[model samples]
Target chain A: MSRFARPHWVEKMSSGMAKPLIGEISAALDTLAATGVAGAIDLSGLPLTATDRAELEVALGSGEVEAKVTAAGTSEIRETGFAGVWWVRHFDAGGRVLAEILEIAFVPQLLGAQGDDIDAAARRLRTELARTPERETGRETVHAD
Target chain B: MQIDETTPNAARSAASGDDRTLGALLAARGVSRRAFLKYSSYLASLLALPASMAPAMAASLAKAQRQSVIWLSFQECTGCTESLTRSLSPTLDDLIFDFISLDYHHTLQAASGHAAEEARMQAMEAHKGKYIVAVDGSVPVKDGGIYSTIAGMSNLDILEETTKDAFAVVAIGSCAAFGGLPLADPNPTGAVPVTELVTDKPVINIPGCPPIPEAMAAVLAHVLTFGILPELDSLGRPKSFYGESVHDRCYRRPFYDRGEFAESFDDEGAKKGWCLYKLGCKGPATSNACATVKWNGGTSFPIEAGHPCLGCSEPGFWDMGGFYRALSVPTGDVARIAAVAAGAGVVAGAAAGALHRATKSAARGKHHTVTVEELEEK
Candidate 1:
């Protein structure tokens, strides 16, 4: 018996007819100019084809900053060639793309969560300390150098 | 920031007629230049100015001299004053209030009787063609403005006499902007907004049941910084604050776009955090910064607290139809309107379903198959 499995549905690389990306970029720029605040375009929520993604990449190109942040999974942040604009992607632990976003701001809001993460770590540490055998005495007898 | 132990020397400044700049007063208050600049940046953002304008705003505001303001009260509930007083704790708004030379305020000033009247006269004379006149309530034109008065003077007489030499006037609340509750149906006292009376001087209307405190503070900042009133819309409101409707900036707009609406107060849709458009939210038509700037120091606003907007900032909102009635559904001939609305909704639904199906089929046709080898190559 043949063991070859049939290939299922796969997304195609579209013909480069994706011009709506230009409007999205323009709107983001307009918003930033009018309001001192920032806005985001969630590509994951849109029906963007592979060709559309490639076209957007060609238009914006790449920029300097590249950072990998960890939450439930890895979130990649890359600055676009356009000043004050960024390309961000979130991927699950299985390496499946979850979200793709184009952010326009003085600074991306994704980086502002370090303080909250620190607070979470503090709570976790306190919980772990409470379960220790020496915690009942409420005093530190052994010290680790 | 530290208190300089010297109470504001408004009396002395007025007596000597010395043009002391705001920088000098902030210096006296021990407010550092950096802190002042930070406050300026905050004000710039609050006023919706570009971030690059912060330094210029700071420089201009710093050099600007104290503005003599005369506050008149009439046919009002004192709620505007109460709202202005509820700024953030140790608020910058209070500091800005302190920076101004408030010459006469019936509710706030310690002086009563002839003393208050004398203060007003002196300040008006000293700062002729320079002072700002801020009125908080409606002026009753009917019956010779006899329904309200100050020191035996009718509200109308006092308003005309006081603003004769004033550079500009700021109508502070809905009462002063559009004749609030006092001018409701069967208005016997014949209360009218200040804009109706003060035609000579420029009037800026900060219309709200009780206008936002920051809004009032920002307007004062604009006057103190630029030496002019901020840009006004057709209704004489500051365009920066009333530029967009509450619905345009609402957080639940995505739900609206998805056509998920809450039909009632405690429905499953409401609990699911759906749009409140069907539940009488006037946000779509109401223009105000309550959805953005919020109240009580950037805290939750009415809509955020699950209450429909009452369109308080717009003129004549009080005379608008029932508060609980949706903007789409009018009060007159409800049965007819409902039937028409239902018909329109059905047609729209069928059109939307067809469009959605077309989009799905197009995506399917565009789809291509990839082998394991192709995935490995990528």
Candidate 2:
């Protein structure tokens, strides 16, 4: 019975269906270009096999922009070879991928600094400056303009 | 694994008469805008919403006030509460605590007895029609609900009163969602799910023996961020999590398609990691996120660990045949046979037979044999 058993299931990871996914991404990119509307495809929600993912990665290649955002976890956003396409992966503290997305946009939304944060930064800076001796002594206002 | 024990600065300020938005609270804790953006994007993906909605979700969450939550336990094992506290995702646990003011929970609260009760009443009165009511156990309505009571108040009465002005009623576990184990066959106490009693409010069912922690957090986050309930399925479960059957997402799906099955626990096929359908896996009939979101921080689900799905998320699962019996096999008086079979299976067959009869009688529907091609279409 042992001899008659088939190969291990791990060997069947490749579904050989990456071409259609690439086509779908191309179509999304086209839509973004035409309508100026960014779109995203949730890779985690798809049924892509390991080989399919590998094929997609190779097809997309890599672009110049790459940044990491740390919040609830660490998110890595990198531009694909295509100018308007980006690959985003959000990982938990334990380094587990929580979500994988392919975004079609000029820049991923997570890269931009929000208005609330900028306001908070300004207040925080003012508080720090108030605690400085130079500011208290009236030496910081040297620019008369 | 590092739990931040210090109370967030925003929470402290809120206590000191500073009414601040969640954005101010987060910023006080030195959480940057990028973090919010990342979390919002992650939430959007998790909720199956379009990626374009991430910015809006973030904006809404930032401007929103902290939500008041009241947790009421009935005839339960406290496993649901345990599951929630042990949420594997690091940030989600913090985010949930930061987003809500848990005014009442018997197990976790410092104040007990009268004080705890008063806190719940106060929160209800203050928040009124805005607070969320999360219930975790089946309500024993038999004997005038004398089977279970807190402070001499019956579970039924408490549920009705608490949910009267609630924004939404969240059924936290299988017991609260589908009348879990307590409602099985010879249900002596006449237990029923939360939906039966709370008819006015939107009841979101997150059913499992002890539901996946992330699913619970995600539902709460969706509600808190959007100021409304997430889209629910026919059974009142969030479609984002319960949209697909376990088998549809299982890695062993290829084996099932090839007709390769594990015959027994220690068989060659089992060792070779074949499909467990023959050994009574309930994956096909079960709709849950266990296959994808998994448990224990994306490590592995029951199927990955070589156990067949118990179909814990579905209604009347406790009565649905035996765990080791195939779904294709029709059951007859399973409750009685389960007794003779003893420990081999729980309340076997009869419940499944009853369900089939119920479905047929209600819909006058025919049970058609599905072909491989038809299954592929789905």
The DockQ values of the predictions, listed in order, are 0.02, 0.39
Q: Write the per-residue lDDT of candidate 1 for residues A7-126, one digit (tens) a residue.
A: 111124453545776676778778898886676665543445455667778888889888886643456789988877888665544454434567788766555443433554577799
Candidate 1, superposed: residue stretches over 4 Å from native: A1-145, B1-11, B89-91, B328-378
Off by over 4 Å in 2: A1-17, A134-145, B1-18, B329-378
State the lDDT of candidate 2 residue by residue for B14-106, as single tens digits: 445667787887778877767766777777877888877878888888888778889999999999998888756776445777777787888
Candidate 1 per-residue C-alpha lDDT over B62-96 given as tens digits, one digit per residue, 9 for 90 to 100: 78888888889989999998888774434344557
TM-scores for all predictions: 0.64, 0.85
Question: How does candidate 2 fare on TM-score?
Answer: 0.85
Error in Å for residue B175 of model 2: 0.3
